[model samples]
Target: MTPRVAVFLDYQNVHLSARTAFLPSGSSGRHGHVDPMRVARRIVRGRRFDGELATVRVYRGRPSPDHQPVAARASDRQADRWSRDSRVVLVRRQLRYPKAWPAEPAQEKGIDVALAVDLVRLACEGAYDVGVLFSRDTDLVPALETVRDLGCHVEVASWKGTSRLRFPDSQLPWCHYLDADDYAACRDYTDYTAA
Candidate 1:
């Protein structure tokens, strides 16, 4: 039987990494956005084992409408677009604005914790044979380790030349290093900000 793969995408992390890795120098901030389903399939295909893509879980941070109406609308639209695919499961957390309001960039709050929780929770529930995390955030390492301890295989995917979680004195957790071709195939140039 083919292994069922569950892909967890940390949106900002992956987007930023992809931009840095593949986009032309001085590309716009939003240029690195990717389609969740496309990315999920690409990574699954890159895996060493023959696997079936089971689900794509996208964890994102949403801007507050009160503070940034335009961005809020764009995020909502993107969410609606992604919802068209049954395999895509989107979890959104509100962005945390700084005390200075628009002066400082709003930070993604709770996204890492949310993704980490689901990574471990889904593993314990036996949701899939393999879990593929797409982020370089070290905060998620513990949860990935927990999933591995549960006997469900855990892997990570990061843009080539970007950081990824590593285990000391062990090779159990594998990583899929996505390259330019993968970025081209998975990128979403849809310009979600457009009305």
Candidate 2:
């Protein structure tokens, strides 16, 4: 029997990692931004899971205009495209803190909580046989444990050196960890693009 897989993505974290890890240095460089949906598809393919994709939920905070305009546009376009696809679902929430922050900070709020809540809810509902998370936040440890206890397999996909150090040891024994570099080979970029 093919396993049903549910994929949950932490948009800000994944995007930040991609931007920092893959994009080239320089203010004028075209940011090499890979489509998140495309990245999700690539992850699914790399996982080689048996069942069809049961659901794909991407969690992102609404973008502020002060952020990189071009990159933001590209991300919106990609997300719009993904929403039209049958296999993917986009879930968005506003970042809690915008004021009193740097003009261009790398972090955001609410994504981790959103991901965690959805992961546990879906697992408890028996929505999927496999749960895949594209983030490295140690805050998700409890959610991972709950999903595993529900008899669903959990796999985490993240950049090689970008993930939280405590994640590996904190995860349940059955949870699997996949380094993003293993799956990002085809999407490498030599230049940075503003986002």
Candidate that scores best on TM-score: 1
lDDT of 1 by residue, 1-195 (tens): 888999999999999988888878899887889899999998887777899999999999999999989999999999999989999999999999999977889999999999999999888888999999999888888898888888998899899888787666675478899888888988888988899
Error of 1 at 121 (Å): 0.7
lDDT of each: 0.90, 0.65
Top lDDT: which candidate number? Answer: 1
- lDDT for 62 (candidate 1): 95
**lDDT (tens digit, per residue) of candidate 2 on 77-174:** 66676677776777775444445555645445777787889899988888888888877677887888788778878887776556542344454333
Question: Which ranges of candidate 1 are over 4 A from the true structure?
Answer: none
lDDT score, candidate 1, position 75: 94
Task: Give the TM-scores of the predictions, in the order they appear.
Answer: 0.96, 0.73
Indicate the TM-score of model 2: 0.73
Clashes of each: 0, 6
**Tell me, what's the RMSD of every candidate?**
1.2, 4.3
- What's the C-alpha lDDT at position 36 in model 1? 93
